[model samples]
Target: MLRIHFAGEDIGRVRIAAGPVPAWEMLLSLHALRGPADHGVFGPWRARTLGVLDASARLLLRLAPPRGYSPDFLTPTADNDIDSLVDAVQSTARRRLRTDLGLLAAQRGPAVWMRPLADGDTTALRCVGTAMFRYHQRVLAPAWDRIHAVVMAERAARVADLLDGGVERMLSRLHPHIRWEAPVLSVTYPVRKELHLGGRGLLLVPSYFCWARPIALRDSGLDPVLVYPANRGLQRLVEPPDTSNGDSLAQLLGATRAAVLQEIGGAEGVTGTDLVRRLRISPASASEHATVLRRAGFIVSHRTANTVWHMPTPLGRAVLERDSGVRAGHGCQRSPARAGFTP
Candidate 1:
């Protein structure tokens, strides 16, 4: 028997025989696919999905107070202490979420499908995938929960903050596009143990891949399990093959090619005219660069509603690394050009 309690806004440690998925996992999933699906639902899918995810994330942050975060924390790719980096990343992401409730609520409800604020025709899952890859590096890796008690001391008020403006407009706007009545047992409690699914039981814990996906434990019946992001051991493998050894690599990924990578990841991912808006380049320019990168094994540009989106290759991250501060080769030696690139 499991005992659950919500004191005011506090969720006492929820101890399940099987653990709940990490909050980050759910965020990543929704973010990964904030684009339209094959059904071609047009604008509504991305908007509604994001609204759902944004809603879910707010709920989770409330439960998992930010802990052990420090100001001077370094990025995971940096040589600074690993633990501090993690704390910083987690803390920063939480802070960003806290302040961005307005953006979340801005695009609410099921009717949002008729005209989603997202403006994309790309599949939401692909968008979420690339976004997660970046999110893990840019946010998750650096967030080590060493001092959770401090950063997230105040209970996150996502619901109160967004829900305050009157539910009538919000839900009514979304009512036409979404189905809230469905059994949505959002599996996002941060402190759960032992998850039983279907006829199986599984263990959940933190690890290199612990912050991956939040499965519907009850519906999927797969028991509780930790999921690793898909990039896994593949991130480094994607580097542009160091073709700098020859012009071969550059022959493939040029400045134009790199820009495509930036565009796709810019506002996470966009489609239709939104893609043009995000890339900030003309349709021809976007198409040409995308074509080149796709040929060179650097990007996967997809089109819908007359717009294009790019998904970076593992090599894409490396290509961006010269600017990213991720020490790949030459053993972290700081070049005078890199100012802070100390050994």
Candidate 2:
């Protein structure tokens, strides 16, 4: 069990990441690749990644295990910028690198390369960084847009929860294994431990490929960060919809409109560009359909910064569910309207 004791000041300081952190995703996905062959959800992606993985890319496996410790320098913080994160890894202090590597070596038994890595060998560190960059290019770059969309959608949902019932409701619903009890938040960890926040608060990062349970940094002295798995429905963001359903729905609603609806149905908080990429439709066409749908009271569109996210209203979900032959209550749950969208 892992317990986090929070102070009054910590409540307002808790934050959710804007998107998936590149380095953390790279590390966790590598761990997932090494695990058992239950790739039913990610089978196509796994196959594609395996085909492109070269000798340099395979070196990342040594840094991350299927189950166990990974060095902290690999994922310095929950920053989402890939370039900055790679630089941080390369610039990790020699003392911290040696200490973190030694801890990993102790747990997994010494690897022959551990000595050089612990000795602050710049070549070894650069080699590891290069491998990480290659793996990201080969495995995650293609799907990053979709991955980010799912993460943002999840963040939007959590934000709604936070608004409706405050921190207690949001924290309790994070995962089935997590519980909020007064000033203490508890998680069922593989090992027994307690973390006193000391008022530094916590950073909540939602990950697309973080399997199963929530993970936290082993080092307590640093800021408290929790990496949790996003909702299971996020998988639909990567998968192509059923052909039969697509054809039937397209026939029911014109091809262009159906395609737009299908994409929005798969993932909420999607932008017009996302639709263009997924459907191979022109931007003008995507905008036209989104306007029509919004005007008809099927979907609601809102702008955050420069991007507009279209979310399916209850009426919209009913239309898709009825057309798809899904029972009314069984369709995707209607997400709450974002702050600016009109009813």
Point to the candidate with the largest TM-score.
2
The digit string of per-residue lDDT tens for model 1 on 154-244 reads 1111112225543222212221111222111123344343332322332322222222332222212222332222221122211233432
Candidate 2 global TM-score: 0.74
TM-score of each: 0.26, 0.74
Using alpha carbons, what is the TM-score of model 1?
Answer: 0.26
Query: Which candidate leads the pack in lDDT?
Result: 2
List pairs with backbone clashes in candidate 2: none
